[model samples]
Target: MTTDEAREFARSYVRFLESMHELAGRGEGNEVVRRVQEHVGEEGRRHSVVGRGFAPFEQVNVQVALDRWSEQPERTVVVEGVTLPPHYGPVTLQQLLHGEALPPTRLTAPELVDLPSGPGRTTACVRNGLFLVDDEARGRFVLFARAPQPHQGEPVLQLELAGLPTDEAQKVLRELDELRTRHNVYRGQTVELAPEMHGGLSVVFPELPATERADVVLPDAVLARIERHAIGIADRREALRAAGRHLKRGLLLYGPPGTGKTHTTRYLVQHLAGATVLMLSGRSLQLVGAVTQLARELQPAAIVLEDVDLVAEDRGFGPGSSPVLFELLDAMDGAAADADLLFLLTTNRADLLEEALAARPGRVDVAVEIGLPDSDARRRLLDVYARGLRLEVSDATQDDAIERMAGVTASFVKELLRRAVLEALEGEAAPDGVVVKDEHLIRALDDLLDSAQGLTRALLGVRDGAAAPGGGPEPHPHTRQAYASSLSFVAEAGPGLQPWR
Candidate 1:
């Protein structure tokens, strides 16, 4: 009885142990399967040796580069993380691998990135997903992320080349560089960089028609010099090089406001249609280095810096002057003489420009002063602006009227013609079609002569204290009354009351 009982208990114990072992084996197998899945996932591939190495902070640029590199959607691989910048909060590895949508807790503060040819203050989020960036270097690129995880120390980014050979990868990189250089991001575009963000610039392609050379009010001598130095040099690059002349040239167009400085620049831009043109002003001066680099890469390029006095302001003036002045000077000087780069800078306050910039040999080889248009030039400007309209006045009367507009700026003339057209349209005598009559111009001049428009006229390049053809500044009724009262007070007070006191 004892032996049988003992044997039954032993058998039961062995059965229990076998069941436990089977359960443990299943759990171990499940654990192994999970590990395998994690390893083969997108996140796992990001850390693999084949992945292109990049910093996590450079995810945007990397995405752009990769998107541009490969057109095939399947071959492109991306990984994202918030690890490199240090300020971004931690993102768990699990959240990344599972293709989980980043929760509000994981998102870093949104950043304002200046977009090319778009509205101001576009927001960029630091999260896990695919992102598109219009880069200055690359036209546009896609930042792709499958499952991105937070990392320690210096974060790394890797692009998986798939089965691409070393030679092919190199060829692709070369092609990418060439593509970036060949297709200009800022050609025929106006752009400004975001002062708040590093390396953030926005571009706007202006659909501006090419201004005719004859349309500009600049002197033919000034235009000729500019054409020869800037446009002509590019055209005769090989000849100039053979003649021991370098293609890199800097020309400064300085003049009072409302002159034809900018107009001349536009003509040059149009003249060099095949050349890359990069226009920068205001905040965009910060990107001078980048602009120069691109210009060098894309030879036969023109970089126009409007209101350059904002940067090249006299260092002695005071604090808050742009630090970019030195950078600009260096860029101009550093560029290779044979690069076929033209720097066309315009400024209303050229007198205030630093001597180092204005007088420097290579910085500004030619300083062309686009002064206020004289009588003949002013007449031409009027004629150009007044084109496509039937004038009520005869040629003789028009010439007389234009002569009377002497001392008025080119800007003033253009504005005057525009106002005249507007007046004609609004007038009861105005025909159904747009026809500008002599009375319309006279009325516009009368409006300009009003004391209220004195400041505006001055701003439009009219000389201060200059009288219009109709008359001097016409004081308002209230002002006339005040003047009369003051005169009376002065007379009544006599010597007893000092007006100064």
Candidate 2:
């Protein structure tokens, strides 16, 4: 059957069972059972008598509030539709919510034999059904009853661990440990997500995983700039306050693609204490209200609205466009009021962004640009990618390759290395089996340079000795001299291109 049909069947059956059980418990046992049996058996003579489907369950109204916990932090879990017996207290509620296993007082699945146990039988509700209590001390249980009450909210699944026999308990605990082991935060020193608690409402940390700074090779100047900004934030810790009530606090990062714009933000989120990262792409802006709600809920978070330019810009809708933008503005303003909150924005087209949105006092506080990687950065990129590979080329040849690929972006360099290294490691098994040769490196460089489209932008668009292969205008003598002299480097090393990496 389709999922909806199955769900309907379960709900109906559960409601009937719950109603009958409640009636039977209140001394109308025989009559309640008779009525139920007849309702199912006689509802239709043609219907199968033994195995008719269940009826929809009606939801119970049970509310659970976490009053206090002496050992663990107090947390509330409202049992949406079911009502708990009066015997339940704050401690019991705590035990129910955060308990690692089912409690001894609760019934197990197998012990349930009938709806309401006759004379001296113990019973409990579980998983939208009922179970019989076999032994109070041993807490062994079995399914004997199935009640149908409407499931109000999703039930919190709990298993009884403390109630298990000694040997069985140990085995269960071992299994639990095994299950938990897969969620290690550190995998051989390369930080990764803790599996079980990866991402959801409270899993923003894993959702915005920490970025490895050493993974990307950045130009010295750009790296230095990032460090200085981080240091400045740290140094101003004591004196820094939230942007005043009128001024919001946000950060803007804009630069060419593959220049580590996104990487830097992720790293910042991982490094900052008590900082949750809430990522919102341009498309999510369609439902601005939901996004705003998330922002309010996850305060003291790094709310990164990447490519805000796409949605926040004045889209010529006049007054209609203001609603969503205004909502976003209010949310950002509220975040600014919280001293611990930090908002980050990233966009490739910073020029397209609304000036007031990014430049206004109550919004973005700082804007930093990330650009291409330079010559030194290119060398680092190559080395980083070739760490486990045994290159057949001499240091001089490798250096020449770096020089040849000097003007390329960091991502392109990494891609080139990946392709070349993979070609070299085709049939090797050793840790350092790959041998990258000068010919491979030269081939990679040639492909990258030849395939690269026209340089729409550059730190300085003066490529003098590097002939214009695409029939572009040649540089004048003075411009050529300036271009050639603009760079400085050690002989046989790589040319140190200024500014743009």
Candidate 3:
């Protein structure tokens, strides 16, 4: 810059140092504030400061960047116990250094907060800390991370570069940005977002169920269709990009509740090894705009919205009028076509989404129905759920149970298997082995089909069959077959029992 600009910049730098000292002087007994001033005094000989702020959800990434930047040669002196009021709102480095008044001071040391670095894991992050660093690359600079004081209006993870020239500060920030991106804690991790204080988001690395393709109880063609839309594209993203195909596509899984939509999603998530997975459901779906931005940044990403019908309560509404649902569609449409992003949405009431999907046509490119499991799928679900159990039952008994389980959901099958185990252990003593027998399966099926289980059946997503759970006469009761509790068979049945693998 010109000499005039340099002089003004230097003057600004001097004023910044004076502001910090003034802040220190206000808190006489606060050792932390005094140390902060002392460090600035030493480092501000010929330096200035630059600052940047990140979303509160990025606390984990900020901590990661700091840790990586401060590795070896560059040591960090963490000031602890520094606190900011929930109402305090500061943006610039100078404003942050110039905290509230003296006596009842807001200084002790910088605060530290625990943030999730990975699923079921967390790293202690510097919250409002004055980190005195001796950087081997960019030399000494003070840094501050604005904490998770959600009440502090629009509170963000503020990071500043103090004690450096303007140009140097910019370069350091760029480096930190690179580090944050390269070693992001959120990358390749499964995160679930929820609304925190005000409208900010709380990002947590949830240990989503690690479902496998074999474990997914869906028609092979349907499963393959979903994979081709999501995983298939993600796997061949480069080739698609080369062939002028847009990677920012959407997949809609529409079905009744308990139809394995979520289970199928888990399978897709597990298969996409390096893709960042962002899952939202219920009220969380309201924060789609902000989440879409994150998805854009973390490409090769999957955005899963479970049961989106919860937000689109008013169906048959005009285009661009349904606020929440339209916002969701708009967010999907906002994504860059070339971005390797997949929007995976699940909904039990596909009718509710018809208008919104129509408004934003290309947003949902592939729509698949995760309908009631057929006989084959039901049998496979039984096998899947019984994988851990020692099931020794006759072929006739197995057929009877499967035949009676028509129109039931995957959840029903899962619960049925569990109930069968309980039935086996009901009155039996520990004989040579504890095996699930014909009697147990029969009894459990009978109990599940009992009239008293109407609500339970509805909860398990049982459409029809027995009493139609909803107490309404649904056409095609059982949808295909019926819920039969009268399977007259003996526990021994002449010893034609086969052990299930």
Against the hidden true structure, what lDDT does model 1 obtain? Answer: 0.57
Writing each residue's lDDT as its tens digit, candidate 1 over 1-501 gives 699999999999999989866654333333322332343444333331223444332344433444455564434333333322345443333333333332222223223233332223222423433333233332323332322233333234443332223454355446544554444344434433333333333345565566887787767776777798778888888898999977887777765667788888888878875786778887667567767887777667888888886876423223765356667878888899888888988876654553445334346666666666777787788778888877776677567666666666687888888888899889764446878887888788767655567667656656533466445743322222222232233223233322211
Off by over 4 Å in 1: 1-65, 72-179, 182-200, 313-322, 429-432, 469-501
lDDT of 2 by residue, 1-501 (tens): 999999999999999999966654432433222222332233221222111111111001000001111112322212111223333321122122222122123222322212111123222323222222223233332111123221322212232222334464455334433332232211112111111211111111234444666765666566565554443453345455543232124666665555667777777666655443456665444333443443344434446666666665534224655634455555666553534445667866555554445333445555555655666787788877777767678789777776665444566666778767666566453574667777777665554444243442132232333323344323322232322321221111122111222
Lowest lDDT 10-residue stretch of candidate 3: 483-492
Task: Give per-residue lDDT, candidate 3, residue 373.
Answer: 86
**How good is model 2 by TM-score?**
0.48
Better of 2 and 3 by TM-score: 3
RMSD, each candidate, Å? 15.1, 17.3, 12.8
- What lDDT tens digits, residue by residue, belong to model 3 across residues 101-155? 5333455644666767787788988766767876666656677666655565545
Better of 1 and 3 by lDDT: 3
Question: What's the true lDDT of residue 471 in model 1?
Answer: 50
